[model samples]
Target chain A: MSTCKTAIRISAKAPRITILPLIQRRHESSARRHKKLLHLPQAPSYAPDRSAPSLIFNPPSSSPNVYHTPLKFLPKDDKRRTLYQTALNLSTHAALRRSTSAIATSGTPLTTSSHLPPRPSATLPPPVRAPYEKKYHLADKEIEEIRRLRLSDPDKWTRARLAEKFGCSQFFVGLVVKSHEKAERVEAEHERMRTRWGARRRAAREDRSRRKEMWGRDE
Target chain B: MKRIRIARCGTQLLAPPSPRRPLCPHVVRFQKTITLHNYRIQSRLQSTAAAREASNFEIESIVEEVESSANDFPSSTWTSPRHTPLELLPSPHPSAALKSAKLAALRSRLSLPPRFPLQTLARTLIHPSADPDPTFNNGSLSILGANLLGYYTTEHILCNYPRLPMSVVFAAQWAYIGPKALATVASEWGIEAAAEPGGEIDPGLLQFKRLRSGDDLPTLLKGKQAPWKWNVTMTNKILKSDEFGSTASRPDAQQLQGMPVPIEEAAQSFVRALIGSLYLHLGRPLTKRFFRDHFLSRHLDMDKLFDFRTPTRDLSRLCAREGFEAPVARLISETGRHSNHPVFIVGVYSGKDKLGEGAGSSLNEARIRAAAAALKAWYLYKPLEVTVPSSTEGEVDTSKWKPNMVDCGEVIV
Candidate 1:
């Protein structure tokens, strides 16, 4: 049962149709194509590469054609590739990351050999380490004695002196010696020790921070 | 378009039989005497007799056409019990559907199938607020549609961004098919609302009782006046709450029947009903296409939705959690440090890898910005290809399907 059929017909022909409707059809099809492009099923991986550069300079895609903005192509061994890869994996929420066991186990990129060897990090500021010795194991009685000594002569038995005698951190010394009544005096002494910036310098610092906050907005 | 009186009578002719109407003895006897197919002819015969007695020429001519059309059908004593007058009906008569230019245009606009009856399309426009009757209103359809919308949207979000924080996921869902978004979609479809719904009104127009201006929302939709309990967890939201994960219980669709509602509520119901009706008539594949074309086509910047309080601390915590070296915010570059507008570029480095970078006027501010940037990077990870669970449903070709990467979920903070 073949379904194909061939027909020969004698027809009474009419006048040729106007081009007006045909032109309108062409225009409509083009407009539809334009609209279709605007809603194209974008590749998920491509969105990041397209978005990363704009986000680096401006946190948000302010322009409608942000996807059209050209990204700098990096070579496989480019040092900037590491920077981009690192930036791509930055943590968004601290609490959520900490709450989940994902902190140490997931999303950490393996250390890849770079074409450009990394510069020595010695020039950067050194990380601060806890100065207290846990093994010193100052007895509760010893802590009590240190506190008592500091209180008896607040001027002579300072936090540093107490720390040195106990072979513990000055922070620990301060914590053991801290009293509500002496808080004001301690604050005043710390205030004196703080690096006092001029009014212009302080204003500059405030302005810089405010500017940073403005930049943080993803627009 | 001119209202055809013949079409109106034609609908009356096709009207379901009066339900044991003892009040109108004559109509009941007339109904019992003739079948539905012959009822129009009988009514026309009576109208013809009246037209002849009254000497009405126009009525006589129209009656001739009705008689001839009735003759085309083989007569049978078939009647189904139904009660409702043409004028007293909550929604427009179904016969008005073919005559409505708006309905015809909408059918073509959506590229609906020719077999998909216009009567169902008209029914989708009648919100429960306008038509209290469940059979006439889109109440049941909207409920079904709402569930379908939620399923499609949730799967799309989860499969695409599996690691999005619960709050962010909820916000994204709200951005897509939530009340406001659905209402926007309805208006974008060029749906117009009737000032008042009646049997004579156009079936194409959305029909609903509008809330008075400056009126407070109904108690059900108004939500809780007090703050939600502190113990409300994401798990609770997933299990107990609506699709958008709000704490407040959704207002019952049935309870809102015949009650005046906001335009947004009415419009949302219409959009959902359209989807529901489409699914019922056109089935799953077309419904999915419609969803993708309409709802998913919207533009929403996921990154901008995030609001962070303390990002620097978060970055450090993130580094610690990932077993990375402690994050150090180092001065990358700076200019005019001594000037009023001194700029400082800071980079947050985890060991040798620089996580993120930002420039600011102050070192501390730059550091904060860098930290925030780093956090955004971590949160916005998307997989290359994902097959939503619903896409594979009832399919024999499992070979092409790739399991979606389900992440460990967003950071709790």
Candidate 2:
């Protein structure tokens, strides 16, 4: 709750509009991943609001980037309106985008509920900040999972699924996956023989010494 | 700041300060008809006894005569054109006509109101090559009309002859209706009138109907034919011309809401008709020199064109060229020459100063435009060309396109 005016410095070159389609595509993939994660063997007693998540996140006249409406669309009654409004308010505030990437990449859903933590933030609209910028809990393991998925699947394994498997929220999972994967790569390369990295320098020194011996013989 | 001066500013003939001597009736009457190049011209003069004649009675009487004339002749004669195009003939002896046989009887035909001197100034269809046969007089006024060019050669006659006005003003009384006058006269005299819109109104129409050509046409045009009155129609048409071939505005939709025909159109017709008569009175010598020097001179005064009230940027353009080609590229092999005849090309800008404003729609359009303007200037002013190259542009070719036809001198006077 540190409310001191965080400069929230913005660039004159705002985020490229190209991020919109990427976000839409990413959202579609994330939804699929989320569906797989929460594939309940038994159907709900009553039909769950298939349309709720969409309505809850979408605000009328909102940025073209933020498509999903979060208000519990399945339940026509305004039961989840407050929560939906809060989320909507969060997405629109210029201040929120910079704060969340750290939390977003954590591996475990912090709520500890059977239901997955919200995955929408992991697949933010292009105009919004990237996953690496969100706040997250399982930053390390989430980063590892993101890396592992990238190394394996032709298409990406979304942040939500990685967080679910790693028992963390997607936003947190996003940060971890980004961070750990990079660390792992460096460690793996260091352990492998350092000669490959030093080959260029060694070759140059040897060529110079051999030329010096040949010139000495001529003298 | 460099404005071109039009010579017609001093075009007033105004019966030149006469001290009570009657107008030389010989040239005004029979000689006008007798003149080869100016044969089709009619008088715009007022009648001597017009003071005594009743205003309303004259028109009615002429109407009666036209109808009677139609009854006299059969319908077969209603289609013959009065004159043919004059062609240049081999050199023959001088058979010029100064004194006419029925000069007195023909002089009686000079009965129009005095204020408007002559009526019906039309060109003959005589070509220069077929001349010496008849139709051409070395000393006479030359009329302007596409049909008349066939009667005389454009090279020998129109090039050398002055540009005469083409208007017909009669005693307003005898010259009211247009079609009926010709139709009645043609039927009575058993001769066809110049049935084509721009052909000669058969001479018999005048003798029998007591009316000149194009005279009875306006009144006889009734119903849809009469739908377009003079001034009203011209205004709508001029506005339409602004939008013609333009996608920027829909011409049909912008049609006049309904404007009244002012008296200006008729006034133009009247005044022009009077000028035509004066031209005829000047006869051939003035007409010849005018074409060679004034009307067809290398220099053309462009101010006389495009009235001042038209403030539209498109209509206000003014440009001229001393040579036949463009002032810039000066493209083309054939440029007009002063040695031969000073040919000039003049241009008037109308409408927007965009594409097709001055001349070129594209760069190609520009060349065609320049060529056409030069040709028109050469015809109207007959100015000398300092030099006409062996080559000239024919069609618009930006990469380089030239005209096939020999770009010869087009004399205007």
Candidate 3:
């Protein structure tokens, strides 16, 4: 990489010297292609002659210039053949389009296991616990007492403070001490805090949008 | 090297101070009398005081000569035919269009029939900024053409993809025949503007007064810009705005007469004029064919126009509206969860039927992708058999006409 950088830096000084670095970059791309091929453990090694100017090789695992991959390597009775073919078919023009990411599906559960490689269950590592889990459970009366204290001094007794006192997660404290009036009041107080700097922030945002619309270049 | 003395540039309005020894003797010369074509025009200007006032821009000595000439022999000009100088005319004479090879070539290039007169084509090239006269300018034709273009584009979008959201439909319309798009189409058609508009220029070239560089744009072009609080409703946009659903008020074409306009505006006006003239001469059938060949043939990806804020919620709402089961996004497959690079494939299902599938680097991303895919599928539904309403016009047989499925518009949030 340092040699490539040096070659590029020196090549700018003399126009004729750019050819060597150009060849070197092509060699690097070819080397990357080889490394990518190496990742497929099931495929045979495709090491080509280094002295040659170019190497032309296509792996047997996949076909070139076509939509569908070659299924010749799969055994006759393999269950994954149909699934793989279906996936390939679905990716083509006729099938459903690949949708973009959006806000609504931001917190969806991840549990799909169909196409995943089957690994030994014993070999897999144990799952980790959530960061905000309570160390000990609270009794019904204790929960009631915490809720009462939270509602009595809504501004003073914040979710964090109540959670710390009860030795429970802030999420659990939130559920226990929920009151519409208290929530609205706290929200109003938060808004009041932000209102002091709101004008400046809004001006900055408007200026940014205006600049972007006019010139298209970022300042 | 010898130092060169460059003369300072000055306009007629601000004549430079008289030099001690004039480099050019004409700079300090006495005003010459006008004997050329001034006699005929001077007598004609006598009737209208406003025209006489406008002629004040002429040399002071020439105006004196015209006044003397008008009093001396007003009968001689009235007896003979009037002769208006070519340079005095705002635009080329209609007869000049017949002689221009460029005009003929342009006509054949567009494959317009010989019946479509070159005079009308020449008239189309003359923007109101170039020639303010209603007969010579393209203002009225452009208005007609703009309405026709809007009608055709709106119907095509609505009848084809009836389920498209209002915003997406507006975007699609803009993409198809907006000012920028029309300008692009005009340039592609080999339309070239003259250096400046005058009677001496070829009729084939587009004629419009060029906007001066760095000048503050006219009020009409600087549309009414409202702040975010204005709350420009979609209903108001549809009812009040231009075909593109823009909230800003467009400049009136008539008001832009004799004023300098941007090249894009001139080019767009030319395209609209061409369509308007074609509709008048060739009738509706040929105009439809021309529209299909030119505008409709351009490639615009409808699916890429969507920018969903919440795809999952929109999809669920769509399913609910259509009386389908509520959509459920289930992870179909995943790999490398603990590693830096994880792949998750998700499928959105409404009951047993899988609506759409997608894959991403994270579970949430995959789910979002799946939901968006399902929503797109619902929006992009096209019936196998379709017939546009325009196709049925003037047809003797209506047997082949099938009623197009009009899906209720996209789910609004």
lDDT of 2 by residue, A1-85 (tens): 1123423333447775444332221332466556665654442212333557442332363111101222211123333456666
Best by DockQ: 1
Tens-digit per-residue lDDT, B1-413, candidate 1: 56445334323323434233334444444435554444333333333232333222222244334344334333342222132344455668666788899998998888887767777788889888887766567888888899999999999988876657788889999999999999999998899999887777889999988888999888877776335457877898899888888887767777897778889999999989888877777678999999998889898887776766678777767766667777777777778989999987776777666666666767777777777777766666555577898888878889979877766655554
Candidate 1's residue-wise lDDT over A166-206, tens digit each? 88878888878775556688788867755587788778988
For candidate 2, write residues B1-413 as lDDT tens digits: 55332222112222112112224443234223333222112110011111322222222233334344334334342211233221111211111111222222222343332322221221111112112222221111222211122221223322322221111011111122122332332233232222221112221111111123335332211213223354444334335422121112211201211211112222222222222343445433433343333123333232122111212111112222222111221222122443453332222211111111122213332333432332222223321222111112232434342212232322222
The B-chain TM-score of model 3 reads 0.80
iRMS for model 2? 36.5
Query: TM-score per candidate, in order?
Result: 0.61, 0.16, 0.60
Q: Distance (Å) between predicted and true CA of B363, model 3?
A: 1.1
* Candidate 3 off by > 4 Å: A1-219, B1-83
lDDT of 3 by residue, B156-186 (tens): 9888776677888899999999999999999
User: Residue A104: error of model 3 in Å?
Assistant: 48
What local distance difference test score does each model get?
A: 0.68, 0.28, 0.68
Candidate 2 vs candidate 3, TM-score winner: 3
